[model samples]
Target: MKKLYILFLFACTFGFAQNPGDIVITEIMNDPVSVSDTFGEYFEIYNQTASPIDIVGWTLKDDGTDTYVIVSGGESGTGTTIVPAGGYLVLGRSDDTMVNGGASVDYSYGDSGHTLGNGADEIVLLNTSMVEIARVNYDGGVTFPDTPGASISLDPSSLNENDNDNGANWCLSTTPYGDGDLGTPGAANNACAPTCQTTLGASDTVCDSSNPGATDDTYSVTLDFSGAATGETFVVSTTPSGFTIGGDDPTSTASGTITVSGVTEGTDITITVSNTGDGGLCDLTRDITSPVCIPINSVDLELIGIIDFTVLSGGSDGKAIHLRATADIADLSIYGIGVANNGGGTDGQEYTFPAIAVSNGDHILLARSLTAMEAFLTTPGYNLFDVYLEDSSEPSQNGDDAIELFKNGEVVETFGDIDCRPSSDGTTVTCPNYQFYEDAWAYKDNGTWTYGAAQCTDHDTGNVPSTWTTFDTPCVYPFVAALSTQEFSEGELSIFPNPVSNGNLTIKSKFDGEMKVKIYDIMGRQVLTAEMKTESLDVSSLRPGLYLLNVSLNNLSSTRKLIIE
Candidate 1:
């Protein structure tokens, strides 16, 4: 069996009356709301202190510029409405005719393109007797002088509060702008928005090595090679950067000798190489007989807006939906394909010839710009944007080069044959370093391969090993953990609009057996509880705050946050 709980008429036990002086500005809708209509913004006042005050003839003014007087007919008397102590009252747009729908308000005022400095603004709350009850000059608006200043709300929701302004730290200072670290605001309201930060590119690693095995031989793989975050782990480019190799004179400052560590016989190892600052013919080879050298081809994909995809090749017409990350080169060449313009209604489409499917292992997905892709398709440029990896059914993949094209199921271009060099004798060749090339798939400069274009060739071993050894590493591609033919079960539980409303809460949960639903304030105080099993709770009686809703079964428990307006 299940149970339900309800809390009703449980408040208002004390005979409290709201007094004129008891009204405190609960919130201000605009911290720096632009002065669009001048008489549009309003103030919300709550009766926190006990006593109901007559507000029949009270005048409200902002910054001593705009004045609004409350009236009944032509004469002012006791306030038409008596706000009980601990109650809510709203004052809306000074246009008397516009009544704020059931929402809480104490005073209402609008603005008209009138800019207020980022400093203090004046607010006066008068009583029906024409006497001032609340008078406070709030230090809010755009900042001034040397220090930047903006409004910060007392409550977390950030609704601006003017009266009963007891707490400090309700201001965002603008003094720190233009310091290379903090950017300045454009408009008055812009000061209260979120701030942005500066970040370095993935290829921007310092190449100067610490330890010197010989002279240039001593290199830090971590510093020389780095990888970007993608849906799957794939090689961007098979190139290293920055530091140079020992006893070898290179054109650029950053270059290093190919050093393979942590390798064992009869096992496969993936090595990434990146040339930081120097540009030259660089490749890798396998010496061991037992370990077979596999040629890894870096696959790039481009998609725009929303589009549908199906395999036309690879014998998977209906049986195959291109897995997120799969490492089947032949399959990728066949049905494993990519699409552009998708459904976004963009222009032009470009995708690699072979689209790799998702498997149990890890795979990398590289995204590049259309302009860069066009250059790659038309001209030869090495603008290796970024390499982000994706695995399994993750909702989103890492960020990389973004493209704005369109795709509607038409083979427009082909991913040309990737050329690789061979060592002398041709007996053994360097294994295609997927991780390395994935990092190197950047844009080229003037047909010259850009060095230090970022790569993932770091070794985690404490003491670097001289011999190449294979270790258990994560899959570097998109894959599926499980294939589902049935939908996931909700188990006698349901949540709608996930983020609910304030005051009027509409909850609907169901189960065949008996269940219990309860609501509690953030402080663990049980505000409402019922044993009816399934029903909605009239949360209008609750205050505007964060509350937790707990639904319990025989042994299972689920919780969700209830936001009251």
Candidate 2:
């Protein structure tokens, strides 16, 4: 039955009525008007039939001196060669040859001297005796909205090459394969096989018996990592336009990157290979066998927020030393004291070797999470007012939502839910639910708990706090500690007395400097400017119920809400 199928295919090739063989020119890139160099121009051919056919003696030529002929002797001009049905054949210039391993011709075809533009150009394919088999009179190349470099293409599939002489465009292949979208190689169809990759520690072992008796060689590639450690990977690849393995459709890679991980010591990996297509030296399959796996370990720890400070109040009057406690994935038990003031009057709490003491002029705050570590520090007052997660850990997670501030192993304050930012879950579910409470000061002063405006609240209704928890004390009220939230980066340049009836706003900065101010109306139109040396700005001149005031210093800008009384 196989021989009969072969005979039937051969007969169709000779008949050449309408490409009788199983092969089809799925793609063609023949256009007379296209301005392309050698690599830029080429033809593509695809086999649509179910059987294989030898495309030997296929000759390609342009009206100019640029001529490309397949050197036939075998499969790749090597032996009895055949392009299996449904396969692809990419034919391009010498520059394009690297794309498909095909022969490259001199670039003399589409030059300005030949006037091969805005009109038809003559291209042909011939057999051994110079007998015209296939040809094309490509119309002016197709034009894209933005692309100037484009070519023509042929559609559908055909079995045999056309046996004609003049004026009949016989050049078959013309699919645009360079677009990175691996479609049918030589056919106009943009359908290509999805990439196939091996498991992390697996091999790409494909058998050749699938396409038995076919000249298209099949190789088995084994990606070996035997006798190596763990976590080893390497790139195994092949070149050629239509090297399709494991399937009939044209594919970008028969097999992709192979990696081996968690291998027991002294076990080598073996990856197999297969190359089932027609081209020059298509079966040069190899492997990155017995590769050594390097072991590298790293931890991404982040400072969540400041825990609590071991305040030694006696050493420095009005100043307390703070020891920051951190929790992370790597080391959870031990902690460190980040920044402190080394002023006169030795601190009782030594942090360097035994412990470090906090001195005057030194303020401690929580640092950001390096990985999963949460840092906690005391505001200026040592009152344990506000507990801020690291800027990185603004968003908290489960397990350590509220860090316990212990004084010498005694739980003095239990910071309830923290508010980093807002969430969709509703104010109660959020850590920073301060803004939701109409009377946030009342909630915090009630001796209950201070909620961050970011605490989740359901806005579906009038945005309200759904969950409430009373804390023994506020985390860190930098505002009350004289640190001033306004001095903090986020709270800098805030205007108090929001309902100012006189438009007299007081601007305060952590750092003292001349402040440049600009007031703008709701429409973003600037109406006033006060480059004053004082911290207070009088905006009573501007008529406004609501306005935006921009405070700038050293090119850094901060905005504040301005209300005119």
lDDT of 1 by residue, 399-505 (tens): 12122221234432222112322222323443231111222222222222221122221234465544321111121111110111121137456655445564444
Question: What is the TM-score of each predicted model, taking all chains together?
Answer: 0.22, 0.22
lDDT by candidate, in order shown: 0.34, 0.37
Candidate 2 off by > 4 Å: 1-26, 30-36, 48-50, 62-68, 73-81, 95-119, 129-131, 141-147, 156-188, 191-565
Candidate 2: minimum summed lDDT over ten consecutive residues — where?
310-319
Each candidate's root-mean-square deviation in Å? 35.0, 24.6
